[model samples]
Target: MTDNSTTTSSVDLNESRAPLLGAVAGLGAVLGVIAVALRFYTRVVIVGKVFHSDYCILAALVSVVAFTICNGIGIGYGFGRHGAAVTPEEITAQLKTTIGVIFFYHLSHLLIKSSILLQYIRICVLPVEKRICYVVLALVIAEGFTWIVVLFLTCIPFSAMWDPGLPGAKCIDNTAGFYACAATIISADVAILVIPPFLLRHSSIPWYQKLLLGMVLALGGAATIASIFRIRVIYMATKGTDPAWDAAPNGLLALIEVDLGLICSCVATLMPLFRRWHPGIWPRRLRHRGGNRLETVSDLNCVCSESKSTASEDRGGKTDVGDAVGSGTKLGPEQ
Candidate 1:
């Protein structure tokens, strides 16, 4: 019986450590890749051109910084820098890093998404429903900010948030802090996905086109899911000996939530540009490459075409029989 108990304890210990290590390593790799991508995008895609007012470059910079800091927190925790043997200062620093990175990363994401959605609206026709949708989107962004405020205030009794060698440090009230965050993120994500379908439903565009738009915009939903997943990891991270294991999954989800949200929001914002491009690529038959030739032969092919009746009616109403007959004869010869 004692042997079984010891084995169970051993298993629990390993389980607790695994997540922290995974989070540390995983976040490091994710941040490194993102940094490289940022460099490439700035160098190759923009080519030193600040010609457009997209502000995408600024968003990219914010994301890079947020992710880098988050990875640092993960690595610190993974290495047991804040373990039981560590000093109060180290524990405090780790918690501060974790909170700072998560907060800034999410805030930057909200700002960028709002900017993108506004840009999207500026180009679109903006019917009454769409305007309402924009208002709702604004509210969602506002709610996220509110949550950030609450999180800060909750931690504001900051000295109480973390302290090594204190037994009651285990009892600090974080329930409100984390739950508020979870609610805000989940609600915003759902709102982003829901608004697209409702706004696009009444558009003059075809149903399939609206569906395509909804699907593209729905990518924000993934970020919401990531937040939920991160919350679970966070619970595991904070409850146990090594919180760093939670950092990898938490950082990964954070990066995903911000990055995917930006991409989805940007795509939605550029919908008008896409709409304009699509019509040029797939114009009506009369507006196709052979459009001029078709018009030229239209009169000659009148019997097989619908323009004949309209043309005859116009000629008859003009009260110029001689010109009408001359034109008709010429049209007949061409046919």
Candidate 2:
């Protein structure tokens, strides 16, 4: 009876958790789609198709699509698990797919950061400022790539990571891997968030424009918050050495955070164009007065005033001439 009760409780717990994870991942996927659509609309319509080396908005779009697919898969797997028991092989496949999804999740951020850095380069007119920005971009790219390498290859001999089902494979310290991932991700998120605001503040654009850009750029910080949330969830979820308990959620959350961040980064890149070109076809107010009529009326008034002034002066009275120059003065300068 005791064993049966324990089995029932375990099944119930898994059943409950699966749907919740599915819902979260599903909502993220939907939001990703909307963000991507907004990005493309801004790029093609507002910003124009002209390729500016500095403004590569397409990176964001690609990121959003990648995220959507990843989250969609998660949602499917999560809900599937809730509905029925999946084999260890199925679960392992799911875990491996998740790992791949998250790998691209971080990769997408690189594209976005590059797009934003390029935008900064686009509006920067000064040689010194441009050179400094380029240098900073180079450093950021190097760091991001380094971080990616560390993230993927941290355990060394990649087979060990997902080879738990295979008794023959040896893996590294799980705790060390977890902490390393958490630390590097947090550091990278902070680094990416830091560079943009500094770059934007000193950028050559007008102060108001820069402020607008800064607000848009701050969207990337939202991903940082997501990263922090994922870290917290992972810390809470994966306590035992079993590894699978913590690894699955951690991978999923990482995907969610980075995917959202990339989408936001792309959206921020398109913000300048959106500001310039409003999405709606807002109707302009029609004035009763035409441009030519306004000019014609002014011309007629000038001619009439000239004739009146000449006749008043011809009367040859100094008082009449003074009165004409004062109250009924000509609309235009005297010839």
lDDT of each: 0.47, 0.49
Give the clashing residue pairs of candidate 1, or none: 19-245, 20-244, 20-245, 23-248
Give the alpha carbon lDDT tens digit for every residue of 1-335 in model 1: 01111222333333443345445445544653454344334333433322121455255446645655665564555423324434556656766666676677657656655654543343233366447657866785787577566556554345544543455434335544565667777776676667656544433323454466457556545567777887766554445444543344555666666655554443433322333345442222122244342222223223123345346333332112111111221212122
The worst-scoring run of ten residues by lDDT in candidate 2 lies at: 318-327
Instruction: Estimate candidate 2's alpha-carbon lDDT, on a 0 to 1 scale.
Output: 0.49
Residue pairs in clash, model 2: 54-118
Reference-based TM-score of each model: 0.59, 0.62
RMSD of 2: 15.8
Best by lDDT: 2
Residue runs of model 1 more than 4 Å from their true location after superposition = 1-53, 60-64, 77-89, 123-127, 162-172, 246-248, 267-335
